[model samples]
Structure formats: structure tokens, C-alpha cells
Target: MENEKDGELLSYSVTLNSQVVEESKELIKSTGGKLSPILNNLLKKWVEMNKVNSENKE
Candidate 1:
């Protein structure tokens, strides 16, 4: 699938705690969502928030 923010798709690996992984899996299944896009959106929101905060401090 194409990414909305940037028209590119990339894949990588990371490690997480077993409990968090299990909960994330259940949440994804219940919400009918995929992990990659969900993580992408979350990271994007985090970056945006940090940028806004940084700008406000200046």
C-alpha cells in the first residue's frame, strides 16, 4: 500500500516486550488495522507534536 505522507513504503525490524506485542496484536485484530500503518501514524503524530512544542518554545 502507498503511504499518504510520503509515497514510499519501507520495512524494518524492531523488538518489543511480549506483553505489549500481544496487546498490540489484539488491538489490531479488533480494530481491523495493520501494524505498519498504525505505527507510522503514531510516529508521525509524535513528531508533529514535538515540532510544535519546540517551535512554541522559541
Candidate 2:
């Protein structure tokens, strides 16, 4: 169902450290992965981490 698929989408706003921003910027500049793609990747990572952590709490 659409709702199930939607649940897989990553959505968040996480504050990044200055060093992390600089590192990600460098990666984007060198790899040309585009800003949105980089951010999307980070968001997905956060979602996965949260899911794993929440599951462990059960």
C-alpha cells in the first residue's frame, strides 16, 4: 500500500557538526553527487539508525 511505502521514506532535520559539514562538502565537491543526494543519503542513514535503536529498546 502507499502508506507502507511512505513509511520507508526518510524525513528529518538533524544538526550537523562543523567538521561533518566541511567533510560532506568536500565529498560533494569531489564526487559531484549533488547537494540533495548527499542530504538524502544522510537522512536515510538517520532513519535506519533510529529504527535499529528503537527496535533494541523493545
TM-scores of the models, in the given order?
A: 0.39, 0.40
RMSD in Å for all candidates = 14.4, 11.8
Candidate 2, residues 1-58, lDDT tens digits: the string is 8866654442211222333445655665676655587685885465556555554544
Runs with alpha carbons beyond 4 Å of true place in candidate 2 = 1-35
Stretch of 10 with least lDDT, candidate 1: 7-16
Supply candidate 2's per-residue lDDT for 20. Answer: 48
For 1-58, candidate 1 gives per-residue lDDT tens digits of: 3464232211111122333445555665676655578675674455556555544544
State the lDDT at 32 in candidate 2. Answer: 67
Report the Cα lDDT for candidate 2: 0.53
